[model samples]
Target: MRVLVVEDDQFHASYLQDTLAEALPEVTEIFHASDGAEGEEEARQGGIEAVVMDLQMDRRNGIEAARTIWAERPQSRILFWSNYADEAYLRGIARIVPEDSAYGYVLKTASRDRLRLALRAVLVEGQIMVDREIHRLQKQGAAPRNRLDDSEFGVLLDLALGLPDKLIAERRGMSLRTVQNRLLSLYDKLGVTVDPEDEAVSLNKRVRALNRALVTRTINVETLEAAQRDLDAWLGGRG
Candidate 1:
């Protein structure tokens, strides 16, 4: 397999190159690029098995580079390594790159074992493994990410499917209180809480707020569409 490494820090980039060389010695070709711009050029070249990229860089940010890479080579698996995982950044990646069997994201501080597993999964299984810590932070809504519990997820699914929350509750054996609590939590997380007296009302508000955020670029269409597409593709296959 051929791999491309894109990082500004020479030492750090070299370390990754060396690690891959030692462990996956059979990885025939390894390419090195200094910054995202060079990395973008390198990535757009011939058939590359995978790319391990740094999220932030001096020349061109990894995200932009990744975007360009995605547009150029949709099938080339990508793994991002960053000290910090930006929510907006994550969202952007989540959109264009299909999950499971091709993409992954990890912290720069990730352990060697974790990195290896991530690369292996993308190369072997073509699945995306989001860093668990990144998942947790996004779940808490500390980042500009949407958080949803099982009940709230159900409500959101209904909304996405064009059903009212009240009707959803009736169809799903969920109590009105339970549904209301879910919406209240959603409203609080979304930072658009009003009276919070009605769960259906709250869901309505949450949907509008989410829509506005998504349309305004505060949330991002690519990310959500990618997520929705994945679910549809996966569930469609299952059904």
Candidate 2:
């Protein structure tokens, strides 16, 4: 089997190549790319049956590279080995993968045997494999009702961008009351408590929720960057 390993760290890339050679004797050839942009370019060259990718990279992230790679070749399997189980990565992965596609998300800390199993599951068996730790994190992150549904998140995003409720409602196609309620739900989910004693100097729960999300990584720089790009495109279209 021909496989591509997309990792910025040279040492890790080499290690992965060696491991693949040992674990899967059928993996006759392995290609390497140092970063996501290079990975995308290599993938575009074709003939790659599967890919082992690192989630975070300097220029273009693994998600972006995977999106383009899958767009070009939907049947290509991918295995992501990363140090983090960040919600942003999970959400990004969820958005790009084709329905019923074979993919894996395993952490770097996983045992070599586990990694081997995941690699085989994705590349050979054509199955989905998610590390136990990552699965736990995904469930924990999703368990909260107020973890902000799409509409609530939309309100929070608009609030983070310093938009008023009226503007947020207009932008999201929600009523002003609905927007306010969603913002309240978001604040609750984010643990942004209102201080009744300081009614005269009330804290801005919206700002608090945004800050909490940023610090906890329920939201991150990438989310804001994507939102900004979307806003810019919307504004451009309006013009």
TM-score of each: 0.59, 0.85
**Residue clash pairs of candidate 2:** none
Which tens-of-lDDT digit does each residue in 1-239 have in candidate 1?
A: 88999998988888889778866755788898888889888877747768888877766767667777877777778888877655655655754564333778888788888877776776546787788977675555555455544456445544554556676676557987877777666666556655657656544575675664444333443334434544566557757
Question: How many clashes in candidate 1?
Answer: 5
Could you say which candidate leads in TM-score?
Answer: 2
Per-candidate Cα lDDT values, in order, are 0.68, 0.82
Model 1, runs deviating above 4 Å: 98-101, 140-239
Candidate 2 lDDT over residue span 79-150, tens digit each: 999998777666667767998889999998888899899989998889988889987876776566656677
What is candidate 1's CA lDDT for residue 220?
Answer: 44
Residue 17 alpha-carbon offset, candidate 2, angstroms = 1.2
